[model samples]
Target: MLREVVTTRYVTPLREGGSLPAIVEADDLGMYVVKFRGAGQGHKALIAELVSGELGRGLGLAVPELVTVQLDEAIAKGEPDQEIQELLLASVGRNLGMDYLPGSLGFDPVAFPVDSEQAGRIVWFDALIGNVDRSWRNPNLLRWHGRLYLIDHGATLIFQHNWPRDAGALEKSARKAVNLEDHVLARFAPDLRAADAQLAPMVTSEAVDAATALIPDEWLVGEPGFDSPDDVRRAFRDWFAARVRAPRSDWLPELAR
Candidate 1:
């Protein structure tokens, strides 16, 4: 389970994101960018944020520390915005939060050049999860303290959004080809071959299990065709494991090699 913290104050809404994730102070005295459960994306977005972010962290990527935030609807009483007030009320329970990075600049390929090795690893990790949001127009990356940090993984692991009744769907999705033409790091000509050799072996069954284990039970509830949250977790674990074992051609961008 993630370390739980209570929201002490709601700072302000980050209007940049469609889901309206906001900056808030937690009881831990640490500021976090919280993704509310009541947001348009729903609980599954929080699930993706936790699972994908943890998976990236496990893969030795620079991802923000994630925490489970306990929100009290009373905090909304001071908010003047009706929309934000309603969102707070709807998200009265558990939500997801990422440690806030102060004054981090949005990643710019020209301003901060990324080496092929690091780019390869990031590109490979994104491909592994079928992330579609890390495009050039909106990289979802931040440059903080001279290091790049990945954020906002709610857009990845799209397969979970439409749980297929077919038992073989997981295996098939694992082998689907990914288009990397628009990936922000594609310009770096990432050596995905080297990235694959160095990183793929590390995504063991144990690692996949560890990543999925971080997801809260409530986030996995009500998933169709699954009897319990553990079942949903098992599905995610199996999918990642299969993707790792799949032929490189299926997922790795040919140009990246």
Candidate 2:
């Protein structure tokens, strides 16, 4: 029932792999990426967007705003470009939403020139989700106004599906490994990285509250949660902390581990 503000004017495919996202316009607004039917992951991908993006913002990372959309199967079929039209006709009835990235340009962290301290922070977030996009190969990061933005988190939490029995173990592994990235603080050291383990507690109540505050309850559709998104956030924090502090912990160092 959430109507997307953006309308499809044109959809330029980004690449060959994963969801073939398209560039779209939002009623005279700037451009954004509209993800039509991401091939083969599952509904869990939406969960990542909801949880990770919310959690990242809670951690003070800059993330794009999310808008629930309903793509008209006709948009693809209506394409003026015959080639594109045919492609859409073949793949109809896909759900779509816009990813807003204003005045942004993709850049590798090294190219954008962030210091090791900040790099460690980005690495820390990635480690939590076992995010696979930030490697030297894909490095799906962007830069704008001299700041960094993390993007493309479609392939995370997958360890959950593959290793269901060890879900708790995997979460713990992510938390503890965060401490191993001294390279992040090498130049900045304890000052910048002080919040490493300290973040576990905050992620609980405050972060979830922040995210759910922005999200409407109706969308959740009776998903299990604490009293508030903040409460759910606390669940994540407590769970993460307990795992990290577990003896002979499974956590790997946060970055450069």
Best by TM-score: 1
Root mean square deviation (Cα) for candidate 2: 5.7
lDDT of 2 by residue, 118-176 (tens): 75566656666556566555666777777677676666645334332345664544354
In model 1, which regions exceed 4 Å deviation? Answer: none
Instruction: Give lDDT tens digits, candidate 1, residues 13-126.
Output: 999999999999999899999999999999989988888898889888999999999998689766789999999998998999999999999999988888899999999988
Candidate 2 lDDT trough over 10 residues, lowest sum: 183-192
Deviation in angstroms for 181 in model 2?
10
In candidate 2 the C-alpha lDDT for residue 19 amounts to: 59
Q: Could you tell me which 10 consecutive residues in candidate 1 have the lowest summed lDDT? A: 162-171
Q: Show where candidate 2 strays beyond 4 Å.
A: 1-3, 80-98, 159-195, 209-249, 254-257
Please give the lDDT score at residue 247 for candidate 2: 43
